[model samples]
Target chain A: MSHKIKGGCQCGAVRYSTDAEPMVTFNCHCTHCQQASGAPFTTAVAVQRENMTISGDVIEHTQTSDLGTLVHRFSCAKCGAYVYGISDGFGATAVNAVTLDDASWVEPQMEVYVSSAQPWTHMDPALPKFDKLPPMEES
Target chain B: MSKKIEGGCLCGAVRYESDAEPLFAVNCHCRHCQMTSGSTHIPGIGLPAAAFSHTGDVTWYKIQNDRGGQSMRAFCPTCGTPIMGQIEGEEILFLHVITLDDPGGFAPQMDIFESSAQPWDRFDDTLPRFAKMPPMGE
Candidate 1:
């Protein structure tokens, strides 16, 4: 049940699309993601970089992830809306699910970095939770 | 002494300091918040405009409500992290809670704009929920 996924920045300065199925969708409660997104957690739809097509100029800001891996964040320069992230910790590009044209279909498989999650943030208990990133095979 | 509430963007380019205590904490599930933050919702704290000070080059995006009210969202140009938002005609400005140096101890009173919330987005059932913006000025 895969469909074309599309989305863009709030200001319409950037846009992206992909027909490839997402590798995995999960929530990231890492402090870096929290600060980067201004949300309690970031829902990431991991996809292959080669299958994704992006238009418009994106500002890349590289920083150290909570995992101590170098993560490259790409966002719209005009609106500062995050588009996707590339990090050494994962093999696929982590696309911000909320940025999708219709994010209602986003279903997270797990919640990571629960140790850094805020007390006010309520999550679905049915999903598996981890204090930090689990082994790639286990994730 | 308690810790000071101060923070900046992911790249440490945009910095802010708030000396006052939190006035209100809320989680907005509006579509705009989702698109801007690239997350399910935005958890922010409202503070007196006078007490909060910030420094850095910020990229501002303006959104107009159906009632003609305007809201301004500020993000860091260097790091692309949203840090602040200002509502027109309002005395207090809202800051993203996660922007705080210590982004803990935040307790949101309610959820607003649940009408547009994504299905996969979860919430605390204990908190009050509103389909859209609640009536202001009691």
Candidate 2:
């Protein structure tokens, strides 16, 4: 079943909508994600890059991933709220789950980069945890 | 026990150091925190404002809390990394835990603002939970 989702930054300066369901959902515990979210980890919902429509002003910053791929992070210029990320390694764009208007449906299927996770940070025991990004399956 | 710690933003444009140990640590589930950090909750280490030294430029945004209190959030404009938050009329400056160079050292003793927490976000059941910020001494 497919449904539309909507969200925006804190200042309401940046908004986004997608009619596609997330292909996969996960939580990242990498150091980069920690820095990006200023939290233990960040939850992400991956959707087809072309399926999402984003509007308003956003600023982008690029960083090299642990796998040596370039990851571009986008955030609201006005409120500094992280909106999403695009990685060269992953063809899909990952939206920050916290930015979603309705987050009750978000259920991460896996935890990546668990080796870098802080000791005090907790994760769902039921979700598969990988020390690093698991080998991607062919779509 | 006391320790010195250092940290900076992703771009390294904003940096901070503190010699004083954290006065307290908490996992905040306030909506303001979720919005600013772009996460379910923010783990923070409260430090005395006077004991912290910061360098480089930061962009500050002011937000009103549920109680109509003023809150100031600061982040690095270059990297969009949240640095710290300050409650109006409060002397403590809460540093984002993940911003610390050694974030593992942080151990949250409590969870606050659980009432505003997203249903999907899980918390450690062992930690004390408060519907709101506990009284100053409690």
Candidate 3:
């Protein structure tokens, strides 16, 4: 069994625990991620829904991802720091690894959608990357 | 009247103060901003760097900006709040408007990078508009 990952909102009002290890960790360079993260990319860790436990009142904001998938953004109602995102079309959800209690275990696997990546954004040269969404079967 | 705005990282390890009002406000419709804010538009309040004061260590995530220059994003490592953004050549710091005492006071002056905007999106047409960032010098 994978070690449990725990984290919560900035205000500590909402807490979540996951028993399943993240299947994929990616840094997304899409413009939406830039605008939302206010940075060049958003680093996320994906895990199966059944392996996670979430608590506290969360406010959800929905958006259509570049892939035409519905991504539900979950934030703490009290503190407002965006916490997690779950896609409706898939059985997996991506958590903000930065918020995890023990995020060291989840290493970033790749950087996605580099075509829209800001020119100055830099990454470690060794990591694998793709210009657009990676095929689901390959990811 | 100069006022001091005080905010800190989630763990209170980093603190900052901004005395000047933003030169402008903006709402980014790009996917990056969308992922960060978890919203339709990520609004920012831009203030000249000279008017801002800060204390404590802020870890920055450097990114390439649209203008082919480097941009620095300072955030609280403890709390993870995106505190501000700074461009290599510009004197301004794009502070997260949401950190303001009266967040509503900072509103967008224009909409930029709209060429990548979504199809179902609709915004007020009365505001100043630009298909992408205004021709550099404008």
Candidate 4:
């Protein structure tokens, strides 16, 4: 059975819960992510938008992604901690898997946005990868 | 807190400078970074949002981050060069280090999100590292 996962914004004012298993999990090394998280790549978990339940006031910022897809960034209205994003490119919502209450359970399967990755950053040797966001061919 | 820096998008559509020192510097090894930069690690420098200054119109795009944060990427649509981004927790706009007028002036202090870095990617051994984004003040 799929496990339930819960998460919230930095201030804990915004919370979310989901019973659906993640559709996918991976790392995005794109410049946007590098700039956003101030890290090498952002670790994310994806699930259907319908499976998630959110509470509290969260602000959203929408833009057309570099891939030409619409993406919405969800954050806490008060603390501005980013909680998740919905992408037309993947037809799914990606939550910062690290923010999940049970962070230990999240597992990443692939890595995207590699082209912009830093020369020094080294990824796992086994995961499949693409220089940029790979097309969402699978569900 | 980091040294003051200056940068903007490629087309000159956006021009801004910042006095805030980077809180941290990192090299991203994710696929999106590679594609966005057409290379490995999008070496990025971070500064608090309040420390920046700019003049010029830039465009933006929102994207999904691995960590579940809302990502606002600002760039010059005309030249298609990314300028900066504003993320949730970190109270700053992430300036694309490359977009800096003097890219050589900035250097990454550490590496984060190393779990997704590529095997062949070469980075300087002198920087600090974390498997994930390190906690602040670590």
Best by TM-score: 2
Model 2 agreement with the true structure over A10-69: per-residue lDDT tens digits:
889999898888888889988888898898888889887788889988768899887777
Over the full model, what C-alpha lDDT does candidate 4 score relative to the true structure?
Answer: 0.64
Query: If you assessed candidate 3 against the hidden native complex, which CAPRI class would it receive?
Result: incorrect
Write one digit per residue (lDDT tens) for candidate 1, span A35-77.
7898889999988767778888888888876666688888888
* Model 1 / residue B136 / CA error / Å: 2.5
By summed lDDT, the worst window of 10 consecutive residues in model 3 chain B runs over: B31-40
Each candidate: how many clashes?
A: 0, 0, 23, 48
lDDT of 3: 0.63
- B19-116, model 4: which lDDT tens digit per residue? 76677666765544443432335677777788788888665555567779766666554444545667656677767676665554556777677776
> Could you tell me the fnat of model 1?
0.86
Candidates 1 and 4 compared: the better one by TM-score is 1
For all candidates listed, what's the TM-score of chain B alone? 0.92, 0.94, 0.77, 0.81
In model 4 chain A, the worst 10-residue window by lDDT is A31-40
Q: Give the clashing residue pairs of candidate 2, or none.
A: none
lDDT of 3 by residue, B1-116 (tens): 13555554434466677767557778665533443343334567677889788787666655565768876666654444556777777798877655444343444677776775
Query: On residues A63-129, what C-alpha lDDT tens digit does candidate 4 reach at each position?
Result: 6778777877665554434467788766788887656766656566888888877664657667888
What shift in Å separates residue B11 of candidate 2 from its native position after superposition?
Answer: 1.0
